[model samples]
Target: MKAEEMWKASTGKGVKVAVVDTGVNPDTPSLKGQVLTDEVPKEVSYKATEDYDGHGTSMAELIAGTGADGTLRGLAPDAKIVPYRVALTGLDKAEMQKAPHLAKVIRAIADSDVKIINMSFGGKIDLPDVREAMKYAHDKGKLMFAGTGNDAMETEFTGFPAAYPYVVGVAASDESGVVGEFSQHGNYVDLAAPGLDVPTWCDKTFRSYCTGEGTSMASAIASASAALVWSAHPDWTANQVLASLIDTAGRDWARDDPSTYLGYGLIRPRKVLENKDFNPGPADTDPLAKENFRGVVDESGKPVAASPSPSTEPSKGTETSDGDDQGDRASATASETDTSGNTTLWVALGAAAAALVIGGGAFAVIRSRRGA
Candidate 1:
């Protein structure tokens, strides 16, 4: 998104986005003036803006980076970032040994005043505390967005935070508008965004930048997109904004039968923002009523979520690797087949390790220090 476009309309100027991930270093040139640490609750406020792993910082940059020193430019540069550090990936060995304490961090965010929450992390397990906090934030009118996880070709399971109802689940697609091979899919995916070879913070050290791929990047873009919409229509409640996004999301499938792979299709903020005459329908009506997932009630007051019967099976996808003449490798185990109909792609490796190998190959070998 361009600054000129934002200036002409709304560029997330007044919106405060809560980046709930590893941590964000305030010293980064692009985020020098955009991070807010004082507002975080005192209990979990330590390292609120100190990004130990670069992933959180990169997400922040994608959401509100000012593009200093030709760094990564955020989708909503004018927005403010409220860093809410969690212990998803960058904790020390000692911290990991103590049994990951993610619940406390989520609880703190639920009590904050930020209106938009961006979660770029998730795992297979659905932590009870985390789900409860999501409900709290939703009831508080805060728009929450999360990555659908990135283990697409391997584990077909969608990530947490995204699985929760009322949360906007984001997947990844390339510049030409094809979904990435690694973006986890299912009924959870609500929107897609750009998440390939994009610039990102190198690490918590705040020393340099690198290019990487993951659903996390896509989630950040989705968050930034929400910030743009919210910035333009500040008076609209969270429900209204989310409803508009779903209603306007780009999709060719039946409005009621969302695809398991693409979900609601790619997100085109340009379409929604360019048309000022667009009406988002009713605020209370959920556009995804007919899709999988059951308790979700639609305009007709019918259940929209999948039932808990034997017929309801988990979705799975198969990824094919190029250069190697081999049969498609179905993720260890999952439900449903992902045939994009016409789109074929190469497979991607796992996250963290791949981020280091593919992105920091030379840097890691020469610097003798791997990113946390």
Candidate 2:
């Protein structure tokens, strides 16, 4: 992506992304003035600013970090962060009990003005309450993104919250647009983003940055990508913002037949930001309506009738590529000139990777990283 030129159009200003994770540290060098602690509801605000494991802070920084003190700079550098703390792994038993429930946290954020919800965590189990909350948020017009888990090579299990309808399941990818081996796959995967070799906070100490790799980083970047498009087109509904992303995403497969590993392909926000006259189609239309309505079941393993009639058309002002072979593991290229008179070539690689399994049940930060 032509990030520098893209910033010339929108820096994700006036947009707020809610990070539902362990916690977020507002005092970080890159996030000093970027976090909106007061925006989080008081009832679900326990330790919201106190990051116990540093995972939440890293995600928040990835979405809105200012790059202060040579720290990691977020894609939407001018976007604001609304932090929410929930009980994920690494928290003690007592702390877990005290932390607000994921369902409640999601409900609170849904009611608020936060445009995007970034969940950089996941687990194998799906809770009924959380699924209901996710539906409520979707109805409220909030664009939600979650990691597709890091256990693709271990098990065929799809992570909850990500598997839940209305949540865009993001998979991890490198700068070359190749999905990471650890990034989970399945019908739930919606998109891919740069997740490998990215810098993130090491721990709660906030002492240094570490090179991290996981779907967690990819989720945060996906949320930030939405922030950029939403900020540029403030009038666009959540559907429209998402539609634009789906329309412009880099892929060699048809929009309807998304790749199991990379979804509609890697996110290319610059494709939207660079073009001022981009059309996002109807506001009431959902780009992922077909996928969202399908594969979602209720408590009794019965399919839920979420929408009246899902549309077959993916989006407007977009065309399907002729690369029909989904199993073709070959790299493709697309090049263009930026507003700054610089040439940029995006390498869209085929998907292939390994996996690892984290503990099941309660939500755990989908962390896969190496210390710097």
Candidate 2 weakest lDDT stretch, 10 residues: 334-343
Question: Which 10-residue span in candidate 1 carries the lowest summed lDDT?
Answer: 361-370
Clashes of each: 10, 3
List RMSD in Å for every model shown: 10.8, 13.1
Instruction: Report lDDT (Cα) of residue 313, candidate 2.
Output: 21
Question: Number of clashes in model 2?
Answer: 3
lDDT of 2 by residue, 1-372 (tens): 666677789989999999888789999877999999999899999999998878888888778887776666677889999998877766777887898988899999999999999887776666788889998998999999988766554445657677788898887665556666656666677787766656566677888665556778778878988999999999999999999988887776666667667778778888898889999999998788777766667999976834212112221111111211101010001011000000011111112211111111111112221111
